[model samples]
Target: MFHISYTVEGTWRLLKRQGWSWQQPARRAIERDDSAVEVWKKETWPRVRAVRRSATPGSSLRMKPDSR
Candidate 1:
């Protein structure tokens, strides 16, 4: 076990010298579902793109009103 007194960079270098490589830990949410994400990408994304492409130039959906 490495001591906390060592700097992060120094510890990384020491590990590398001993033939160990650093790996990033996954930061995914605990409740995330891969199938649900895939379904959204395949189904919902295409419908959203179609609506955006079919919108007219003068339509309210395509225009942002002045904030001032």
Candidate 2:
């Protein structure tokens, strides 16, 4: 067992010398469901695309600048 006080830089150097490195955990939740995502892609996406494509004449899904 070793007990020593070190500044931030000194601590970082010590960790490097001891074969340690920084790491980041995954950004997503572990409980996320895969089957639900596939169902949405296959079932919901086509309906959404159809609605967007069925716009009226001279009108669009995008926001247009008001000419008034």
Candidate 3:
């Protein structure tokens, strides 16, 4: 049985030579409706905000001042 082994660089170079370009998929859908999104946000954003506020009581993400 024979198998080919490739280093990371070798595989990347092979893909590059094949015309592959690295990219991330778009976060938003191309066919999304902006007005519908705005309406959903207006109705649901308050509840989302409330959940976070209720989950963490008196806790802050900010760092404490230096006490030195």
Candidate 4:
């Protein structure tokens, strides 16, 4: 028989800031024969404490310069 569990943290954008970051947490469970076992998992992403808005007044931050 075998069992495992784990936890992970970080933001999608900040994690991707360095490179192409597309991460998903690893799944864990127990393996056994004729055994009764229970499993549970929870995923939580903390809200962005400091969500950024436009860089300047009356300007769009996500807009590209070449598009204007």
**lDDT of candidate model 2 versus the reference:** 0.84
Return the top candidate by TM-score.
3
Each prediction's whole-model lDDT (CA): 0.83, 0.84, 0.83, 0.50
Query: For candidate 1, lDDT tens digit of each residue in 1-68?
Result: 67457788998999999999977867988889999999999999988884445555664575787699
How well is each residue in 1-68 modelled by candidate 4, as lDDT tens digits?
46653345445555567786666757543454323322211222234345677677574477766744
Cα displacement (angstroms), candidate 2, residue 34, comes to 18
RMSD to the hidden true structure, all candidates: 13.3, 14.6, 10.3, 16.2
| Predicted structure 1: lDDT | 0.83
Model 3 lDDT per residue over 1-68, tens place? 47988999999999999999788876977899999989889997877874443555563658875789
Q: Give per-residue lDDT, candidate 4, residue 59.
A: 46
**lDDT of model 1, residue 4:** 55
TM-score, every prediction: 0.34, 0.33, 0.36, 0.17
Residue-level error in angstroms, candidate 2, position 53? 56
**On a 0 to 1 TM-score scale, where does candidate 3 land against the true structure?**
0.36
Tens-digit lDDT track of model 2 for 1-68: 48867999999999999999997875877887999989999999888885445555785458887889
lDDT of 2 at 14: 92
